[model samples]
Target: MASKIDPILEYDFCVAFLSNKWHTPPSNLKDFVVTSIQQTKSNATNMVSIISNFLKNKSFDPYVKDCLRTCFDLYSDSVSALDNAVVAFKNKDFDTASTKVSVSLDSPVACQGLFNDKKGENKSPLTKENRAYFQFSVIPFVFIQMCRIHN
Candidate 1:
């Protein structure tokens, strides 16, 4: 019979991966995880705020405005979901944290989907602005996967 993989080892690997991705040395494992999740949440919130402030002051075509507004709402939802995930994780409710993080991933996808037409051409102004969000979004998914591995 094959030996079962230890969850603590898996969790350590996950934390190391996140720390490397963030280009920061690992400190306390749980603290690192919680702080990294919080940073991702802050990023999502800040991006939404910036876009919303722009939309509020500028004049764009009605269609464009609607698209921007949709992106704003999606980003906001992502932030909220991430917040919930972090809270759940802190509470040691890994299942709830995983679910919330998984849900949060959809927001960015839906936000990006707004840029596509039936033919799937991507031309939304938000694309360039929001690109960084997509990059960082993967970390949360990784965190969720790590939790699964730990479980």
Candidate 2:
């Protein structure tokens, strides 16, 4: 007999972000991939909303405001990429899905880079959010890799 597999174990990096119910017994690979992508898209959408709210805040300096605007654009691109990823997955195009997910993953890094000066003295207010989004974005990519391995 085959040994039992754990879906949660396959997504170790996502454990902190995943809910208690997501830790239950193993699910099929397709279900896991779908869930991972959908959850990531949802998280990215929330990030966009958070950044949008930050852009509306008038207390920040011009430099900070410019950084936030760039970050906002980056996150918007991420949301669009993830949306395309979802459609690719639905179309059973794993390669396209993987490519789209990879594209979505770069937003946080690019956003964070905008705040670093020559001396690296500047810090981003969205540090925590960017880190969280990066982690969240990794889930679907990992799941897609798993699917590739299984196939």
Clashing pairs in model 1, backbone N/Cα/C closer than 3 A: none
Regions of model 2 farther than 4 Å from truth = 1-13, 22-26
TM-score of each: 0.72, 0.82
Per-residue lDDT over 1-151 for candidate 1, one digit per residue giving the tens place of the 0 to 100 score: 0012322224443455455655555465555557667777888888788778868856666666777788888888878888888888889887887677666566666777787766778757677556556555556556555655666
TM-score of 2: 0.82
Best by lDDT: 2
